[model samples]
Target: MNLELLESFGQNYPEEADGTLDCISMALTCTFNSWSRDGHKLVSASTDNIVSQWDVLSGDCDQRFRFPSPILKVQYHPRDQNKVLVCPMKSAPVMLTLSDSKHVVLP
Candidate 1:
């Protein structure tokens, strides 16, 4: 796959943006979850054991949540603002609840 890193605002392309993440083995698909009002953060997952929360405004990964198995899909809850659903390829789905004070892991 061809990789190109654009500017923070995605309005222009940088000339020297060729860094790749070595942790990702295979990226099947990715989607943006619009949970925040400012639209700054996005959750992305791959066939690897990593789930990443990226900052679109800064073009950097803010936080990463790792899984025991390879992640098949990731999605944000529609009604709940602090919940994310993660599905693995071989196991049952997991619910990750993110709040201001604590992080809850549910099976």
Candidate 2:
């Protein structure tokens, strides 16, 4: 990942940009979300417990969802573009519905 490219996304610190790249690479998750239906948005979850939705065209964060603990992994719902499944350290996996701002704990 190019640090310069990530820095363009409003990252004020080099460490943060590096962390974002690490998360994207480690997770191998979708950098582009289908939520936009236009391939103009992306999502990334970092160990810092923040899930961010980004605007691909503008290089801005569309929204950020924070959790109580460090995140272990993140997965998006296969069909629900507005939803993401996050596994937090020492906690149950949660289903976060972005559109409605609902957090559901999975058993």
Candidate 3:
């Protein structure tokens, strides 16, 4: 299967709280609780421990990021969009480098 990133402003719906937390690709049922804009690109986070990036012109998700814990909010660095701030519900916010996923600077 192709692993292309697909994300954008998605409408959310309520679902039964099952025994598991989804951390996979979000179809239309994913609800974005927090979001931030970086030029023409959009970055958003949800309760599914996923962070997705989308192109504004086409409304297509270009990439999806995963975290160990559920994401509460996300923000793009003011100077560099590649550097993202991921705030988890149970942990401190981390500054992640999208290119390598190596950095974990404390927030």
In terms of TM-score, the best-performing candidate is: 2
**60: Cα error in model 3, Å:** 2.3
For candidate 1, lDDT tens digit of each residue in 22-105? 865654554334444446667788555777767788889766777788777777777664677877777888777755424444
- Model 2, 1-107: lDDT tens per residue? 86776555664655544443334445534322334444666777765568887788899987788778877777667766687787778899998887878899999
lDDT of 2: 0.71
Which runs in model 1 stand beyond 4 Å of their true positions?
Answer: 1-38, 100-107
> What is the lDDT of every predicted structure here?
0.67, 0.71, 0.72
TM-score for each of the candidates: 0.55, 0.59, 0.58
The local lDDT score (0 to 100) that residue 29 gets in candidate 2 is 42
RMSD for each model, in Å, please?
A: 13.1, 14.4, 16.2
Better of 1 and 3 by TM-score: 3
For model 3, the superposed segments whose C-alpha errors exceed 4 Å read 1-38, 105-107
